[model samples]
Target chain A: MINKATEVFVSRGYDGTSMDTVARELGITKSAIYHHVKSKEELLHLAINRGISALDSAVEDERQRTGLTALERLRAAVHASVVILIEYHHSVTLLLRVRGNSDVEREALEQRRKIDDKIRALVAEAIGEGGLRSDFTPGLITRLLFGMVNSITEWYRPSYPVDPEAIADAVTSMAFNGLEA
Target chain B: MINKATEVFVSRGYDGTSMDTVARELGITKSAIYHHVKSKEELLHLAINRGISALDSAVEDERQRTGLTALERLRAAVHASVVILIEYHHSVTLLLRVRGNSDVEREALEQRRKIDDKIRALVAEAIGEGGLRSDFTPGLITRLLFGMVNSITEWYRPSYPVDPEAIADAVTSMAFNGLEA
Candidate 1:
């Protein structure tokens, strides 16, 4: 029921949606919703928590793996993120649209920043090991990396049946190699 | 008055904003706004026109300039886009938020595609001249280039003293160099 509520909230935004709309979408009474959750904010919290937890778990799993270089580990983490995002499209979309406008949004933003910091550290290690280019600032590279990955949400459609791994590989290849013919 | 209208439109979005709200923000009657534009849609058109024209004119101007390499011309065209976007923040913000849900938005999307085509041609030429790396796909590079540029509208703050030229340089540098040690 909260998952249905999250889909409605993400598609319509927070202020534009109401408890009545969520209940209607779920084909349930408002009282029934109250039986499960106290308010819409609780639903928002649950949605963001699910999305963030999935991502955190993915990165943690990748970090636990051994024998991979920092570059490889970072790529694995990015691939895990893409997979998680594809699996939880609705919830992740809500996480992305968060504007730090509410307590839930602010917490999401902070968690996102922590993930970015972790990714940036991986990029730094690759640079230190001479596996990546050293001329660009890490800060700028971090922004570009996130910009490209985050942008996939804007265009990715699951109905197309394309492999998510293929998409991740393409991005990794393009980032590592320049377009010259 | 139109500036105030644009501000409201950018802040609240086209669908969420109402004529009365714009009027209230301006401390004027709704009838007064109708004297300037037939409807809110007309205001949206007027606001987006400047940004689209600026982009089109910049690319056209760069195309006409001779004695420059394809890479140089491409840089000039993109730099012009950043500069124009800075000067016309409100309009570009509206342009970014456009969902291609209306005729006006559809037209803007088409024009944006044209701009992308022009830039992609330059990138292709640069690749032929060995100015860029050849291992990556041109299509992916084009998307990343423009995506990073477009992402600027999401975060660029006019309150800062940074020059748009510096931003263009930073973006170009980040695009060409990977973060390696």
Candidate 2:
């Protein structure tokens, strides 16, 4: 049910979507939807929570937890983020497009900020360890880095034969080596 | 009038914004707004057109025109895009967030896609000229590159003491040299 709601949210957008629409999409009565989810806000909370939890898990994965250099951990985190975003594309898309119009959305936005701060700290750590450049502010670098990864939510489609590994490799390569020949 | 409308649209979102709200924000009568723009869609068109025209001019700037390699043109385009997006942050933000639910929005989206394709072509040309790495697909690289640049619209604020030149230089350097030490 959450998946169906996510699909509706992703396609119709959060503000435009209503419980009635979700029910219609699911071919069920609105009462049935209410039985499972109390309101559209609750459904949005569930959907965004799913996306946030996946991202949090990715950041805390073993690759980032183990004895790795800050740069290595950052790389692992980036790759994991891309994979999770692609794997949960609809929910992530909905999460990214959120505008924080309601209390539930504002809470989701706070959670997103927490994730962003965690990544920013990792960038600062890598720079401090002499594994990444310190010339640019870590905050700026973090925005640009995750900006590229978060873009996967905007363009990646399941119908396209895109290889997740290829995408992860390309992102890490472009981010680390850059595009210069 | 379009500026005020853009502000309302940016704050309340396109769907949630109404002519009544725009007029209220502008301290004008709704009929006064209708005198300039027949409908909310027309106001949206004007606001988005302003942003699109600015972007088009930036892409066609002299720096991208004379005695520049494909890579140089690409760099110039990226810098110009960032600068314009920052300068017109509100309207550009509205343009980026448009979900294409209306005819005017769909038209704006088409124009956006045209701009995106032009940028993608430049990326391909740069790669062909051996100015950038050819290992990654040009399309993917283009998306990531613009993804980083476009993120400026999300966070940049007029009150922030951000120097556009510094931002452009940092973006170019980071895109070229990357984060690795």
Candidate 3:
């Protein structure tokens, strides 16, 4: 149901989508949707949470990884992030498209910032531990790294027949090792 | 007038903005704007064209650079792109935001594609010359490379006290040599 709702919301702008539209997409009654969620906003909240929690949990899991260097943990975290992004394609799209227009949107944006903060801290830690190059600021590296990763959504369609792990390897390779031959 | 229109378009969205709002933003009469352009779509065309031409010219100039390897030309093109993106901030934003809803927008997107094609060709040439790694496909590398470059708009505000050259250097450094210590 949430998947159908996300598809509807993505095809139609959030403001343009309605419960009836989503219900029609699902070939179900509006009351049936209402039985599961109170409103369209709730559907949005749930759909985005599906992505946010995956990312949040993945980063937390990487943090718990034992015997890894700070740099290794950071690489693992971003790999996990790209995997989550590919796995939760529509949900991540919704997350990226969000603007803080409503209370719900603002809260989602805040949670996103916390995730960004987490990654930024890890970048700094890696730099401090002599694992990452210090010439670039952690903030800048984190910005560009995620910028490249999040951009996968713009082109890496699920039907492209490429593995998520392969893309993740490319990202880490281009990032940690540079693009030089 | 084009700058004001671009600003309005970026903030209010293309569909939501109008001549009246742009004129109001510029503190001018609607007739004054009418003297400059025939319609809102013209304003959009002119505004995005400002960016498109700058980028197209930059890439072309880099292509013409003498005594440079394909890898060097590619690096120069990306550097010039980041500079143009920073210099023509609103125009690039408008160009990026376009979804080809109208003829003007479709034309803009087509021009943008031409630029992408040029860069992709350069990537392939660089790989053929053994300057860049052949591990990633040219298409994938171009997608992620431009994605990283384009995302600078999201965070690298003009108010930030950093030189465009500094950012360009950082980009080249990260792309060529990576973030390793």
Q: Tens digits of per-residue lDDT for model 1 on B1-181?
A: 7666777888888888988998899999999889999988888888888888898899889966899888778777877877877777788888877888888889988888898888888888878788776554566567766766776776678764457777666665556543333
Looking at model 3 chain A, report the run of 10 residues with the lowest lDDT sum: A153-162
Best by TM-score: 3
Kindly report which residue stretches of model 3 are placed more than 4 angstroms away from their true locations once superposed: none
Give a tens-digit lDDT track for model 2, residues A1-181.
8887898998876777778888999999999988888788899889888888999888877345868898999988998898888888888888887777899888888988988888888989999999998888888888888888887788889875669888988888889878899
For residues B14-70, write the lDDT of model 3, one tens digit per residue.
Answer: 898777788889999999988988888889999999999999999999987899998
> Which fraction of the native contacts appears in each prediction?
0.38, 0.71, 0.84
Across A94-139, the per-residue lDDT of candidate 1 in tens digits comes to: 8888889888789999998888788888888878877877765566
Highest-DockQ candidate:
3
lDDT tens string, model 2, B57-140?
Answer: 888672358778888898888888888888787888989987788998899899888888888888898899999998888788
Task: Score each candidate by Cα lDDT.
Answer: 0.76, 0.84, 0.90
Model 3 agreement with the true structure over A72-172: per-residue lDDT tens digits: 99999999999999998888888899999887799899999999999999999999999999988888899989998898988777787669999999888
What's the DockQ of model 2?
Answer: 0.73
Q: If scored against the real structure, what TM-score would every candidate get?
A: 0.79, 0.92, 0.98
Show model 2 residue runs off by greater than 4 Å. Answer: A62-64, B62-64
lDDT of 3 at B74: 95
